[model samples]
Target: MKKTIPFSLLALLLYLAAACSTPKQRVPEQTASYTPASQELYDTIARMDSVMFDAFNKQDPDKLKEVFSEDLEFYHDKGGVTDYAQTMENFRTLFERNRDTGLRRDLVKGSLEVYPIVGFGAVEICLHRFCHQENGQDDCGTFKNIMLWQQKDGKWKVTRVISYDH
Candidate 1:
C-alpha cells in the first residue's frame, strides 16, 4: 500500500525547492568613471590632504583645526582616542613642549572609495618624527590610515581618522 504525505510537509518541500532554485542577488562592481561634481569633490579632498600634511609638519594647530570637522574623531597608534578639541589641544601642547621638534609624512599609496554622499580614503604613509635627543635620532615608521570625509557646505571635510602601524 502507498502512503500519503502530510499537506504541511508537501508545502515545506515546495518552499525549499523554490528557495534553492532562486539565484542570489549580486553587488555591482566599482567603476572608474566619476561625475563632474564627484571629480570636483575628489580634487578638493586631495588639496585638503596637502594642507593637512603641511599643518602636521609645521605643528600648526590652527591649520589642523581648519581641515578637521568640529565633531572630528582621531584614533592614534599609541592606543589613544581624541575628539576635535582634545586633539587640537594636544597638538598645541606638543608644539609648545618641543619647539625644535619636526615631523613629516610621505604618502606611499592612497585610494579614494566614493559613495553617494560620503567617501573614504585608504593611505599608506611613512612618518619621520625628529627631536633633539641625546643621539639626535628620529622616530620613523610606516602606517596605514583610513580617513572618512563628508561633503558639507560644498566642501569635503575629514570627519574621522584612524591609523595603525603597518
Candidate 2:
C-alpha cells in the first residue's frame, strides 16, 4: 500500500512538471516593416493626396478647411508659417479676388516613406493657373511639398504640410 501511494505521488508530480514545462506556442515577434502591397494603407495615403489636390483645384475653402486638422500648420513658399485659420483666410481672399480663378494641378508626384510607427511623403506639384479676368494668362510654378502623415486607429491623417517653390 505504501509503495503504491509513493508511486501515485511521483506520477502526479511528474505530470505537473511536464505540464508546466511544455513550451508555449511561440508567437512570432511583430516586426515593423513597411509592406507597400497593403491595399488599405496605400489607399489611405492616396485618398489624402487626392482630397487635398481636389480641394486646391476647386478652390473650395470649406472643403480644404475640412481636409486639414484644426491645428494644421502650413509653410508656403511666399507665405511663411500659416495657421489653419490663416491659411483658410488666404484661400478665401484669393478666391474672392478672382471668382473665375481656376487651378490645374500638373505633374503631381508622391512617394511614401515608412518608419517604425510613423511615415511621411514628399510630393512635387506643378501649379497651373488660368483666369479670364487676368487676361487669361497662364501661370506655372513648381512646388515641393513635404507632408507628414500618421496612422491613427487604422486611418491615415495628415498632420503637417510644408511647401516651397523649386
Candidate 3:
C-alpha cells in the first residue's frame, strides 16, 4: 500500500516556502520630483520649521523650548550628543556669543521633505544654513538635519534631531 503525505507535513512545507520568499527593500526616492505622502503634513512641518528657526534667529530660547520636547535628543557631528537641557543651554550660549552680529538660520530652497510616522507625528529631513556676520562679512555653514516630531494633545514638538555634515 502506498502512503500519502500527512496534512501537517504539507502545511509545514507550504509555510516554509512562503517564509523563504524575499521581502522587497524599501528606500526613499532621491529624485528632484520627490513628493511627501501628505501635502498637509508637509505644510505643517514646513511651517513649524520656519517658526522654530525664527525663534532661534531671534535669540529667543524660551520660544525654542516650546518647539523642543522635554525628552529631546540632539546628535551633532562635531559636538556629540546632547539632551534637552544641554541643548537649550548650548543655544543660550550661542545666542550670547553672537549677540553682536547675531546668527540666522535659512532653510535651503526646495530641500525640505516630510514623511509621516503612523502613530507618531512625522519625520523632517532638510538642508539648512546658519549664517552670522563675522569681520564685516557673512560667515555661513550648510548642514543636513533630520528631525522627529511628536504630536500630543494637538501640539507638536521635536523629539529627536540628527544634525550632521557641517
lDDT, candidates in the order shown:
0.64, 0.59, 0.91
Sorted by TM-score, highest first, which candidate order results? 3, 1, 2
Best by TM-score: 3
| TM-score preference between candidates 2 and 3, better one | 3
Worst 10 residues of 3 by lDDT: 22-31
Superposition TM-score, candidate 3 onto the true structure: 0.80
TM-score of each: 0.59, 0.58, 0.80
lDDT (Cα, tens digit) per residue for candidate 1, span 23-100: 432222324553334565556656767788788778788888887888989898885889999988987887787666
RMSD of each: 14.2, 22.3, 14.4
Tell me the number of clashing residue pairs for each predicted model: 0, 0, 0
User: What are the runs in model 3 whose C-alpha is more than 4 Å off?
Assistant: 1-31
Task: Report the C-alpha displacement of residue 32, candidate 1, in angstroms.
Answer: 15
Comparing 1 and 3 by lDDT, which wins?
A: 3
Q: For candidate 2, lDDT tens digit of each residue in 1-166?
A: 3535588899999999988895533222224444454555556656776787678677788887766767778887777889878878988887777666555453233334322233543232222222233466655454455666655565455567777654
- Please provide the root mean square deviation of candidate 1 (C-alpha atoms, Å): 14.2
- What does candidate 3's lDDT look like per residue over 1-166, in tens digits? 9999999999999999988985543222346877889999999999999999999989999999999999999999999999999999999999999998868998888789999999999999998878899999878777889999999999999999999886
Query: Which residue segments of model 2 deviate by more than 4 Å?
Result: 1-40, 107-133, 153-155
Model 2, residue 72: distance off in Å is 1.0
Which of candidates 1 and 2 reaches a greater lDDT? 1
